[model samples]
Target: MIDVLYFAWVRERIGIPRETVTSEAATVMDLVDELRAREERYALAFADLSSLRVALDQELTEFDTPLEGVREVAFFPPMTGG
Candidate 1:
């Protein structure tokens, strides 16, 4: 199972802070397809991949990142901090 965390507006659309998901997804994009298929909230939350950033096991990653042996996956809007 992978711990999927939703931050910022992504959490608002999904109505949850995090969830543990068991998936056979080959890549992060595949996982998004699975989640987006599960409900409308996910569809809205992941509507624009361009506006989102992802992390694998806490290190920043891309959508094509593989899921094999992944322990965590976090999704959030691009951070802008000073």
Candidate 2:
């Protein structure tokens, strides 16, 4: 099981902060496809991939990154240096 974490507007849209999911996805994008197929909220939250940033096991990474032994996945909007 992978711990999925949603932050910022992602949490607001999904109506939850985190969830533990059991998936057969090989990559982050594949995992996203699973989530996007779960419900409309997930679809909306992940609609625009370019607007989001992902982290694997707390280290920022790309969507195509493999999820072989990842324990955690975080999704959130890009950070602004203000």
Candidate 3:
């Protein structure tokens, strides 16, 4: 199981801050494909991968990063300076 976290607008769109997902995905992108298949909210949230950033177990990483032994995955929009 992986703890999937959503921040900022991502949380708003999904209507939840986080969820625990049991997946067979080999990569972060594959995990996204699973979530996107679950519901329209997930589909909308992940529609534009370029606008989002991913962190695996609290360290920044890419969507293609392997999910082996990972415990957490977070998704959020890219940070910008004010």
Top model number, lDDT = 2
Per-residue lDDT tens digits of candidate 1, residues 18-59? 999999899999999999999999999999999999999999
Steric overlap count per candidate: 0, 0, 0
Q: How accurate is candidate 2 locally (lDDT)?
A: 0.99
* Residue-by-residue lDDT tens digits, candidate 2, 12-75: 9999999999999999999999999999999999999999999999999999999999999999
TM-score per candidate, chains pooled: 0.97, 0.99, 0.98
Q: Which should have the higher lDDT, number 1 or number 3? A: 3
> Judged by lDDT relative to the true structure, which candidate is superior, 1 or 2?
2
Question: Stretches of candidate 1 above 4 Å error?
Answer: none
The predicted structure with the larger TM-score, 1 or 3, is 3
After superposition on all C-alphas, the RMSD of every candidate to the true structure, in Å, is: 0.7, 0.4, 0.6
lDDT of each: 0.96, 0.99, 0.97
Better of 2 and 3 by lDDT: 2
The residue pairs that clash in candidate 3, if any, are none
lDDT score, candidate 3, position 72: 97
Q: Which stretches in model 2 have alpha-carbon errors above 4 Å? A: none
Ten contiguous residues with the weakest lDDT in model 2: 73-82
